[model samples]
Target: MASKAGDDPDSLMSLCTIFCLKNLRRTMCYSEGEQNRLQLRPDVFLPGEICDRLVNEYMDLVHTDSDFEPQDGFFQLFSDPRSTRLTRLQLREDLVRDRDLEAIGKQDLMELHLTYCSRLTARGLRTLCSFRHSLLSLSLFGCSSVFFRKSGAPLAAGEDEDEEERLQRHTVDLDFSFQGFNRLRLLNLGGLRAELDVEKLLRPLPALTSLDLSSVHLPRPAFLTQWSERLASLVLYNVELTEELIHMLLQMSRLRHLDISRENQRTSKFKMTRKILSSIVQSLVDLVSLDISGHIMLDNCTVPAFEDAVGRPSIEPCKSSIYPFQELKRPLQFLGLYNTTLCNVTHIPAYKVLSFEPILRLLPQSSAPVSQHWATWALYNLVSVYCEYFTVKPSHQIRFHPKIMSFSV
Candidate 1:
């Protein structure tokens, strides 16, 4: 017996509510933007009406997946108050059309995350300007084709034909504008390759405090002095670390967190020298966290002095030692040193007691020449740091170095 379209569960609104409640409840604990996968069956498409209905239902249920939970009290206690007012729409790896997003523009969306959405054109992205006033964060990670036109608005007739002609000839020179996001605070443009005019992009977004440009091949550093004072967190992962780039970054006086981990040896000249470290430490007085991992040249020559400045306990410097610099003014809380040539044991500086809690993560390099003595020293240092703040684990390889402290692996 063929069921009527009105009677079908897929078409009925009641079934939509039931299906959403069931699936969303399973993953209710995950944050709005945290769930990466949606188990939609392949070779089948949800009816357009159903899709629209689901989108609306999901937007409405942004506050809570279901009233009852295993830990109802705990869930309510930590629930976001703003979740009820603003919805977060995450559409990833989908063939989403312009109309699909245009419909979404009607709601007050706080966050819009679109990853690998190749079908969403430049025009589709521009359409989002309609709700720009309410939107707080927008992440378009790995959407390569969508771009910003240099001259954002369309050219008027009989006015600057030469400029239009040049633009037509060099369409590749186009870039995205940051006009819509007036209240945007966090933006992630990871894996986007374009020559972005930093000054122009940041001019409109004065409230923007956090930016992630990881794996995005940025053009030469320019106009960083403009918003350098406002940015609190920045990620320049795998970017070429030049002296000029460092100079540009140092201008950001209010930056509290920074990650400039150059994983690949893109160029031999890319070295984090003692001078550069000193400049960063001296300039960015508010820096609380930093990561300069994966740079081979970041050895004891620079790391020891930096550690000491930021409050690391007294540890012996390497054979090629550079030492006892001015103590760090800013209270650094976290330091990362994974896959670097720098010996973990050495260069742990003497931090001011009770001023701030510090955490140092050090994983030995695969290509490093490991010796018994070096391993023991590393182990000892790790134990000393661990015991200072945290309890030592029971299962361990304990060893006492004659010169250094006792450590366990």
Candidate 2:
């Protein structure tokens, strides 16, 4: 018997509804697959309407996909108390290529290290600098772009236009001023040979503690006199060293560590004399460490005699008055006399020795033949032991072992 049309209408409606549902399910599956392929992580869930608003407002600056996201483990490593307040961000050679740096904004950044970043350029640096106030510490070690001009002659003195025009033309250079960092402590401009206005650069950083200008040309000695006494450490790698420069550095009475290794080179024409070096050393009454190695002048000089003479008592008459040069009252620890032609092992100074193996090898003919292999092993062990012990306490009981102390015979 055939069913009536009205009675069968409910069953027909049910069949149509099932077909529509199946299509809707397929569409939903396709949409999900597309979303997954995009590789978006679970969205950062906002707690309330207020949070949602704030997050949406700054969504572009925040939210990163899995590849761009900062690893939790890496973040945890830098979450220590020592590294927490570290406003200076160092982008090492390994991390420089990472795209994650784009996510890092300069909200509280004070310093930045872009050492050995061959790919980094002035344009990118300008962009990075725009995020923060003028960076306090800007390290561009081994970065060639920073030192040399890309094209054309160096920016001339209004050779092209008026003040407004010049300003517009060199907006990037003007904005690259270091004036914003009044509390800057350290600046490492190693390998930069640009004609930087040292006085202008330093004027902003009144609280600078350390300055490294290795392999870079600096302004006149007169300019260094203007440096603040807060400077505790200074490294001059391979630059001209004059008596005036030495005197200017002497003005920094609070300087504790000074590396004038540039003066120790064999090919260096401007060799600092024993008298000048000794005078400079004497002036730094508070100096706790000093390194002057690789220079022919120092190489030829008698190490023991030089050390003893520098440390000896001497009465000298000045233009106005006379004063006695007493032994450096501050413990002159960690002296690096490396690459010098000093042969006598017994003459080596008795401070916490880092490397005596080199000196041992150069000992007199009477001394036993030093085993090169044993010396290498001993040096490694000494460094390891010293580092371990020092890591525990940086300032106390810094001593050497007898085994490492055993010179030749």
Candidate 3:
């Protein structure tokens, strides 16, 4: 009796029958209450839950196996704006602990701006300095914690420490003794307000091209003068640009760009006069561009002198009598004469004037690689104003082209 086909106690169920029973139970238990608790529809939750569960279950298989390649799970999770903002602190902490993970090969990462990151302390920065070999740019713009706050203590008689110890204790002392980044191009230490020895920092960076010490309370020009050949661009914004500093810059024949704005603290006889400006420009024969804006003391004469110096020929006249006949062959290509009425067309050579106004109109029409918005605007305005002075006849087409002439300022 017990050995019957369907009612036998020892009889086994077929695979199809077992699968049908499991599906039936799953369908019956799939309710809206469960959907509501998970805040997702059953159709949506089912696939997502299955994917997450599978990933967790096979995590080792995916990570360890040479053939398996998983998607960027971290990027998928943190790409959302909410997730980015919420987890930034945690991410920073994790990055600090796993410093080696941030080393993404031999790419220059100079002037890193980690502003408002409270957890990024001096120790963290010191750790990050391991990348100094490839790091030429570093910008800790609003990192108040890394900056020095004056400690109200008098000098101790017995404590004589080394450069590394001094750097750790003092905010201004940047001890970069660990060498490797020989190709550092630009260093912007703005808002640090520390007393940094410019020479010490520059000594390590043999390939340094630009240095911005805006509001950094740096030492005298002598420190910079030591590495004049290596420094091509110098920004002393809101810092003091003394006569000595100007002379130092003039002596640096390789310097191409110099910004000495009102941010300079020293009040010296560094007038933007015709003779002084011309002399300064004349000294930098290799300069391709020069910017001296935001200094209210500069007058209209400064413009002509700048143009004359830039347009002057690299080769000096043999005698004073041959000066008038000396012609410039390579004039400065880019000159920033912003915020000054000194752009008097009469002072510049007729053939050497390249107005920006016409160039601006032509830029939109042309297919050249003019990318920067501010630079485009500046070119447009410059050409437009310069074109106003030139009387173009209806029969004659007015063209604003960059002038090519020898260095004869």
**Which scores higher on TM-score, 1 or 2?**
1
Clashes of 3: 37
Which of the two, 2 or 3, has more TM-score?
A: 2
lDDT (10s digit) by residue, model 2, range 153-240 = 3432333233234333332243355555665677877766355555554566666788887766665756665564677888876667
Model 2: lDDT of residue 279: 74
Put down candidate 1 lDDT per residue, 55-76, tens digits, no spaces: 4454345434555232212212
Per residue, candidate 3 scores C-alpha lDDT tens digits across 204-297 of 6667778777655655666677557777887775565667767777788788766665422134335565555666656776666555543444
Against the true structure, what is each candidate's TM-score? 0.57, 0.56, 0.48
Ranked by lDDT, top first: 1, 2, 3
Per-model CA lDDT versus the true structure: 0.54, 0.47, 0.43
RMSD of 2: 18.5
Off by over 4 Å in 3: 1-119, 139-180, 194-201, 262-270, 297-329, 344-409
lDDT of 3: 0.43
Worst lDDT run of 10 residues, candidate 3, spans 86-95
